[model samples]
Target: MTMFTRNDKGQDTASPATAQPVRSDAQPAASPVAETRRPQAQPISSSSAAHGTPSVSVISKALKITGQLESTEDIQIEGEIEGDVRAVSVMVGANAKVKGTVRGDQVQLAGQVEGKIEAKKVILTRTARMSGDVVHQDITIESGAFIDGHCRPEYGKAEVKAPGLKTVVAGS
Candidate 1:
């Protein structure tokens, strides 16, 4: 990314187009002086990371998912879902009711789910109810949630079956 910078005197610096590092054959590969000036990432200890991942947000009530929902950004369902949902992060709302499968990087439920769920992270919130299986890398369930069926941290694609037997996807 190129940045437009201003000097302390409020004068515009030279355009980034003219700012190019000159190539030189004398340059050495990997210098400790340059390395020390940069911040390094320390390896995380085994214990802390083993605990679990974190959540971005929660679902309330109002929104409704009637079909397959797919995205890469984080999402929270606040109303009802009648079909599948796919994303990087997902949350079933407190008053939400999902009747189909959900596929995401992370998924949480606080209302009701009747189909399978596939995600990296899965959470069943308090007052949430489910009647299907959950396949994910991580899962969390608060008190008041009701669940039925299987719960697998990892599973195959063959195991994920959406209910209601739809033949085609929307907007195909």
Candidate 2:
């Protein structure tokens, strides 16, 4: 039982050696005063000004989302999504599952998608399994990918517009 007990002293001692480098880095910092002030401000409040927000949002493998997801920045999904996803760039990870439409400037899928994909550029990787139509200005379907619906190169075409919108007169 004594042998099984953790020996944390070794790790604690090693931590000081690593900490010395950080101390040395702090000593030569261009703005030491600003760096000290930033830490003080960070402890007072957790704000985006202290640490900038990420430009890309990641949906981890453990997550399951059921509503529409819209973002101007890129999105990486490794979980399950049951509703529409719209982003500047969307990446569906190898094990991700999406059950609704995905719209983006660029879309890369390596997982299972059960609905339509509309994008300027679309890529289906070897392990991708798509069960619906894909509308893209440019598309690449890898050799081992599985697709059950049509792949149409008509992403930005007028025909892809809403059905009633095309029939409506501009002034009326």
Candidates' C-alpha lDDT: 0.61, 0.78
How accurate locally is residue 139 in candidate 1, as Cα lDDT from 0 to 100? 83
lDDT of 2 at 52: 62
Looking at model 2, residue 71 earns an lDDT score of 77
Report the number of the highest-TM-score candidate: 2
RMSD of every prediction: 12.2, 14.0
lDDT of 2 by residue, 65-170 (tens): 9998877678999999999988878999999999999988899999999999999899999999999999998999899999999999998789774212233232
Measured by lDDT, the strongest candidate is 2
TM-score on alpha carbons, each prediction? 0.53, 0.66
Q: What lDDT, from 0 to 1, does candidate 1 have?
A: 0.61
